[model samples]
Target: MKKVITLTLPGELIFTRLAAQTAASVAALVCGECHPKDNNCEFINAFELAVSEAFTNSALHACQDELPPVTLTFIAERHQLTVTVRDTNEPFGIETPQPDIESYPEGGYGLLIIRKVMDTVTYRRDGDANIISMSKKL
Candidate 1:
């Protein structure tokens, strides 16, 4: 059987702390899933970073208005961590990066980091919610 753990945090700055917490949570769960094996430090660190970026992205771009609420969920399995961040904000897509890697600005690197840390990144619209899904493999 597959095990699932769900967490719902408010659409506020405080939830930023939860990013690290969620990372550790996923790490532990992944450890359990892969018991008798060493902890996957790289996978855990990447998941944590991706989760932090996704949460910060929602806080910065999505919940700008006095909207309802934002939520983040993590689904961990044997060798993967799938995260879904839901928000009720304007659906915006990531802008294309500069062709010249060196020409890229110092900022606007959040998605870059997320893409590097996550094996897959996807965005979708569910009703009034914009859902961002990021996954990392162990």
Candidate 2:
């Protein structure tokens, strides 16, 4: 079976939590059973973190000067779950370098963390949209 959830939210930091919660619910409904042995809800946590980070990036930086809404999609398949975050930002590089850990920086690690947790991540530009697609195996 296949299922999908989509949300178009205001481009603001405060809305990140809504996206995170939605992602968590979809992950749990789609593949929570895969983590029966995990007591800390690792499966759900990963999705929440990834979605939150992706949405935050778009909210915090995508608009440049104007506020354009952001789009998120969650696709659940038999063996994996894919989340896609889309925005109206100009095309940017997805190969983000790891932040200087020694400096104890507070930011610049969103993409890296997403890469670490999700099994697949892809970026594409479709006309005026910047699409970030991420997925994890179930």
**In order, what lDDT does every prediction score?**
0.71, 0.87
Q: What's each prediction's TM-score? A: 0.80, 0.90
Residue-level error in angstroms, candidate 2, position 21? 0.6
Any residue pairs clashing in model 2, and if so which? none
Which residue pairs show backbone clashes in model 1?
none
Alpha carbon lDDT of residue 117, candidate 1?
Answer: 78
Off by over 4 Å in 1: 32-40, 63-67, 98-104
Q: Model 1, range 1-138, lDDT digits (tens) per residue?
A: 445666766666678668656765666567554322234666666766777877777777645556346677777777777888888877878554734567756667788888887889998888877898887777
Q: Quote the positional error of residue 37 for candidate 2 in Å.
A: 15
TM-score of 1: 0.80
Those runs of model 2 whose alpha carbons end farther than 4 Å from true positions after fitting are 34-39, 64-66
What would the per-residue lDDT of candidate 2 be over residues 1-138, giving only the tens digit for each residue?
A: 888889999888999999998888888888757443344677688889999999998888865566799999988999899999999976888887899999999988998899999999999999999999999987
